[model samples]
Target: MNDFELLFDPIREHYRTTFSRIERLVNRRKNYSIDDAYINLSIVESKELSSKEENFHSDANYTTFEEIYGTKRPIEIEQLFNDNRERLLVLGRAGIGKTTFCQYIVCQWASGKLFQQFKCILWIRFRFLNDTRYPKKSNNEQYTLTEVVENECFSNKLTDDGLAVLQFILGEVRQAVSNSLPTILILLDGYDELSVCEHLQNLIDSLMKSPYQILTSRPYNTDDLKYDAQMEIIGFTNDNIEKYVNNFFTSNEPQKSKQLLTFLESKPSIYGIGHIPITLELICSTYGEENKQHAITSGTTITITTVYSKIIEWLCRRYLEKFCNCDKRHLNLKDRSEIIEDCSEILDVIGSIAFKAMEKSSLILDKTLVEKELRKVSPKRPSELRKKLLNIGVVKSLTAGDDSTNVEAAKDYYFIHLSFQEFFAARYLVNVLQNPKRKCYTKAINFIQYEKYNQRFLLVFTFTSGLLSGNDSLSCLETFWKAMTSEPLDLIGPRHIQLIIRCLEEAGSDHRIPQRSLWIEHISKWVECAANDTRDHKPLQTDSLAPN
Candidate 1:
């Protein structure tokens, strides 16, 4: 049996004994006592036995005790019952298993295995409570979180008054506690999600003072927690990641298993980031079946951006086919080339300006500068587009305080999540530069050539594509090639020129381009050097001299 199983044995026995005694007492007066009297009597009698008091709070309901501890084994039950108040806080990047860990703890506690030493377990999902539409609730019912908790505490109890059911639960809990049977353990998960609510501070204060309580939250702006112990879930270490990968691969396809591992190793930033188990599972499971063979044969990194891009691509393609086909529902919509051009121009301008700020300068530009640059294109709010960028994880939003108005600090709005930015930039570049039948290319070429624009665009494009691996495919290269060749390479410089040639070479003999052989000789020396060190910087002159 597991450690948790053994720890539960005594608690289980105690509960059994308590139930037997309560049953015996009820049997003796079954006929004489009225239903209400019996209810009160049983509650009163339960208080005397102290069946609930022994460890109700220690039962591990609301808090994610196990995840916070980073273990599955049962901890010494006595340790949690420490008299001094300590706090544990969990912090990590987005989509890095914070919430999942919290849930795992709830499952353990609910099972009555690990935290059985606690008298009562209470679990709360702060988001659900905070999200309740207070405006629609009864005018007479203004409730603090504590008041709400007091009500929910008695939800499972027997109560004659519907409005006072929660109070009844609390009463039962109090009576249970007064008996000094089991210690109570309260687990509060996603404190960050709730802490934003006006009532949350008060609720936290109440919890801190309570004899039994634990809380979990995101690390941002969540400093003060009077928890008995402070535990931060820093995510899986490299060993933990390897262990999880090994476990995951045992039953999965060999190719998908290999692909995910390759993906994990390719990017330094996302090494342990994707190992959140949820993200890894989502990426592998979503893309694994369809491309299992390809993934196995070709080493590819699965980045959060690439995963999101795949989903978006599928969505766009589906909608495009559905709305505008040769057959049914073809809304003979006027070819609003100008509108498309306008939108493309806006995106291009923003991409160019943002690229300059992110790539060329040593000093990072603030949001105000970014906004100023964007204003040159159109007066429309850039915040929405910025939000879209953040949503897709291309550029993360950083804040000084937890409040919204804080300007992004240094390295704040970068394309470190290369795959996601590639998805956006590649799409935007194609629409702007590769439209075969439009005047957009002429304007785009002119725009790109204007005053150090090439350097900015190149930096933007390269840094954004660095994180892409197998799944990114050759799409970005094709898009870039099409853009570069449409105009003279001299305007853009040799680096972009070689970039185009390199893409053509990698595109292989399938495309039947004579330019591949012609340029390969010109680029061979630099290419040979790059073969040894892919990240080594090459001179712009080398790029210009290398054919084209």
Candidate 2:
């Protein structure tokens, strides 16, 4: 191998070996490879992604893009990397396919389908960058580009020879910086995910000097980085959503895809989240499991929370089939929910893990944390329980190796995606934490119900509120909702409204009918809170927000 081939062979090999194994986030039963399911995403040139009309008004109103911002120049997908743009940014909300789009670019480039001008493309997920703790060498205050590149290529952490090979890659970047003839493309994804660190900040600043780079982040999370061009990934359009449904069903058996589209159309709120690719995939999988789609679409208005809860039910039913060799076919979701209750012991343990991770605002979980929680649920045989949960694919373990290794490739565990983490956390919040049976529930409850809400737990609280009105009678959340509403008008801020409204949105507006007294109290408190800035009224009694 000559100089260039020798330098990039590892990245090429790493992509080849691992890319196919990469599952679409929350894809059920390895249903489709990304290649078969991947849609070529279109981008509109705009600075704003969030909707102005959406406020604490309602939760069912998924964000609609409305802004005064204008698109300066639009570039087609084909010409995205063909020109000489030094820096570009792709922004979207959670689950809007930012990471998937980055992966698609890597796949295309690896196959010689795009970005041929660049000699090497380095795709580094900021989560990994945050997970990695680079030792503070006296000589090096920041992480080296070569080391970062080698570590995140999804290969075994290179201990020794990785430096020289990737230094050659860096050498090309160095030339491009001076000569202004860019030869490398660095794709830094999820900038918002990286934890606070001085070394990582320095490293990020260093890497941003690349002559050509593409950064992806949730909207407004790109404060630290600069870009020449900014594009928003709006995810699937109505037509694109239709296209995804067609791609999901290969057999076209029983016309399941057609049913899913019709179901989505009837429920436009559900249709809004269908724009998010991962949620769309789960909706399709859950709907395809049985013909009882009508029971849901025909019955009452289902919210996003209802969809996710049904997916969990689907998981339990599938677990019975795959693990226990029990097959109960064509049963309605209500009947199938008994399976979830049957599996509650295991689900509780997993949900606890999810809650703890989310409480810390982290996706990565330490191995010790996993074992400790596992022991609580099944002390007699934690190992067996661990195996079952891993097999079920909720929590995953990273490859175990030396902590000092480049990838820091130790036995760290993480959820399949951030949203699942939040959902399961929400489940635990309603079922266990909020339930009064547990003696120390008061101590646990105070942290979540603090005066100024922890911004991180907003989604957790939304899901928590949604789960309250779900099929299971979480009558305890009646008190939970009252406690949320009973706060002084001064304590009821924008986030509080967001939390409650989103909860109402997810649970369906019809949910408030039975709890009319509580809803009336909540609306009354909110109306008072929104009107007054009460220094005259005492500030709320708030405990310090802590992470698990």
Task: Give the candidate number with the greatest TM-score.
Answer: 2
Candidate 1 similarity to native, TM-score? 0.41
Model 1 CA lDDT for position 540 = 33
Candidate 2 lDDT over 357-386, as tens digits, reads: 665656677666788888887788887787
Q: For candidate 1, give the lDDT.
A: 0.40
lDDT of 2 at 423: 84
Model 1 lDDT at residue 80: 42
* Candidate 1 per-residue lDDT over residues 131-186, each given as its tens digit: 12222244544455435543333322222443343333334345644553345555
- Give TM-scores for every candidate, taking all chains together and pairing residue i with residue i: 0.41, 0.79
